[model samples]
Target: MGSEKDVLVAAAVFLFALISHSEGIVGGREAAAHSRPYMASIQVPEGENMKHECGGFVIADQWVMTAVHCMPTGPNGRKVVLGVHSLSEAEETKQTFDILELHNHPDFRESNYDNDIALIKLDRPYTTSVAIRPVEFMRQGGTNPGNDAEVETAGWGSLDNLGSRPDKLQEVTVDVVISALCRRSDYFGSKFTANMICAQRVCPQPCDQLYKKQDTCDGDSGGPLLFNGTVVGITSNGGRKCGQLKKPGIYTIISHYTRWIDGILGLQPDPTPEHSD
Candidate 1:
């Protein structure tokens, strides 16, 4: 029992780390309400209070996709809240559901966050509305949203490095960084795999002029990285600081894991392996 408790505690911390950023959003702005309808908040009980651990996205009526690292180890109260902009106040658009099941990828590596994707089965199907829509996934054979492409990311993560959780959701525009450049960074150093993609917050000015880093922090983990309004990546990991120079945020490329996801969703998995650009 003691060992089991220890494991649970460790798992809790890992989940927290995966979702919570000590250094918060570096260059993010408050998002408009209902602008990101597919956003889902994964919440877990922490003593007397419930905390948002990670961000996810609705894919189907009853399915959510998130990082495998955010999976709860023990049943200490877990649920997903959708269609809400504010975490503190109740809104008519808000819909909460208990998690019926969690399916982590079979090859997910905890040590390195390889294959860091998972599917969440909600207890009931969510009613579709303008404020509660599912996000489209990158289709098979779709062109990769290449390096330097601007993408949108949203979450209710911390506002700064001191760890101040936000009441309202925030958003930032980031650019996809070349994989080779990302792999060469001092922090990641060849750890990137085929399943991973790297992105960096768009600099306010060109690097040659002025550099202002923007990125997703702790609470943004498992959130969708949107390209052309479709989910291209899921937040995985980043540097110790939220927005460090050259330390691009890592994400689980959705296209690479479509087979695993399709298997869980009862859809046909594509036989051909996706090629990265």
Candidate 2:
């Protein structure tokens, strides 16, 4: 995961995904088939058909991670749809599972959106395939890509602020906005915190920072924010309107809850060294 080739690959993604000229996607493009095998769609039952509610990503064969707000309220529980690129297509590799259990961070609060993370235990393990696998989490001790570094986020989020959802998965490249800037009164203000991160599409040459750009909107909540080929954050929320000027997409920083996540996964903590007399 620390290889130089991985960095080059990430660099390549941003190099070709230059700033967009169109208002496309709030500004994004359709992703390639099976390009992101770890992507999952959180869907709730609507009569005979399942309705897409939010996005998630597989962290392990049987565990999926998402925003705490994405958890269903009633007993009906949401389903985890993996290995899919389009919500409407019945692809051969697509796999769906009823959630066996859900673990939301105990301190999570919808009001301030702090500690807004959750994990889903699938009824069964995901089928490993060219179209199904887990996304990489930043290993312990890994560092963030830092401010203004290009990162990629994908989802079937609304194509516009008016609630236009799409069938095909979409992806966009954005730059990490330093927290201090996002914490300004004009931005998220007191609502922003260290545990949260903000990112937005970079404007093309000569454009201002607030220039309209691509961003995740409704139905994109609980999705992943990948930096350097690993999961580093989860889509939490945005402003009253999607792609609103100055409201960069806010995310729950994954590293802040790694211990809780690892504990829930039953993983052992790193051993401490013994002292000699």
Candidate 3:
């Protein structure tokens, strides 16, 4: 009975992570190899599993980064599995672990979905292997990503909006759309700020509705938006339906919050200036 309960707890954690990828975001960019990136496999609480989505990334051996939404309830009794490539139930690589502490952004606001970042302190440092290494951050001094850059997003969300959910990580490439285009949309509203960046299809024509599968959907939120192998944005939110045009994907612009991230992570900001020129 005790073992069965443990297995149930493990399933909840995986399910939450799967849901995080369900929420959509934008863009695709080429990644440069700089450091190791780790995905957080959160151990879900019993009933809250239905509300939360798993989120985690390695910043330190004992620390994982994620979104506030990933913890539907307070941080007690959660866990994080440090190293794994696939989160699929059928996959042989998945492992289960526990969370030590959840340090959510102090200014995190749930009302409008702003300031959604959070950090998870693991109960113990994860042992590293070839498949699982630590990921490097801008650490307050990295350059901003380009608007036209290509980025890659990986998650376990559904293959297409309103379709069957995926059990394994699904990676897709997207191009960053200029902020002006993203903000000007009637759907995004004036709330779109420098703190946010947007991405969408580079097509001159509209996509098919039934098969309009290029955009992020219900579970991709809180995932990494990588450009040039640097973390550029946090997968946040978008309009109601996925892949709808003039309603492009939106993200928490990483460059705009470097200081905040640095402050939280206790890292020094970059000394160099970023130029639009």
Candidate 4:
């Protein structure tokens, strides 16, 4: 990571903090070939009129959730589009909605990426479509995942190590690694906190070199981390490289922030109507 000033600026501009010591990831297959599908796609405002960069998703009829880094406190007008499959507006069947309110986690800090979560209220409820719908959260007192759990991830990020952004959304499957191993990884270690969860692949002892490509990079941030049909975490950060060994992907643990989110959303433990499958 860079200095606080540089990290803040890059976050404000919706650019990845491509700090030094970064390198290329393994080529060919993606690490998340069987992960769950993503539910949100938000376009954040940038320099001038109506332009945006960051992506987000609608977590409720009126609320869209995403990474806090995508939008720092600013005067920018961030708009969101639900039911969108492609970045192109014409390809989307649902109409775009204005962001009536923006709420970054009160404790969010761009410098260190702590409390990297935010929620936006849409001006209008979009018509749900196959491409878009409010993803249901695991019911209250629901099942929690164990070590090495099977999970899926989806996003509209870069497809290859050196490739440009994907035109359409993509989905993949990956496995959760032991939290202890993940915490000890270079990506977390000193910076790891109870708010973050780690996920990665567990290759067989005599694995082929192809298993090396299982990880997330930039652009995949703010996406969902689903396990057993429920979102357990939200993509936050990882190693600067695309897929570096001993450096697992870090996500904001959703359960840890449930009360904070509920306080913001003003809901009970089981916020129904918005959480139906």
Q: Estimate the TM-score of every prediction.
A: 0.85, 0.86, 0.73, 0.75
Candidate 1 residue spans exceeding 4 A from truth? 1-24, 72-75, 202-212, 274-277
Residue 112, model 4: lDDT of: 56
Backbone Cα, N, C clashes tallied per candidate: 5, 1, 29, 15
As a whole number from 0 to 100, the lDDT of residue 206 in candidate 3 is 62
Model 2 per-residue lDDT at 250: 92
Q: Write the per-residue lDDT of candidate 4 for residues 1-277, one digit (tens) a residue.
A: 6899998887866644331111122222322321222355666555554433555656777787788887776426657765655565465364677778778888876655778888887787777665656766544456657777877666766654674566455655667777777666454665777667777664568877544466666677888878866787777887776666677777776665666678788876444332210
12 Cα displacement, candidate 1 (Å): 40
Q: 25-125, model 1: which lDDT tens digit per residue?
A: 55677787999999999998888767898999999979999998888363247889999888889799999999898998777887778888889999999
Displacement of the residue 157 alpha carbon in candidate 4, Å = 1.2
lDDT (0-100) at residue 265 of candidate 4? 87
Against the true structure, what is every candidate's RMSD? Answer: 11.9, 10.5, 10.1, 11.9
**Model 2 alpha-carbon miss at residue 74, Å:** 6.0
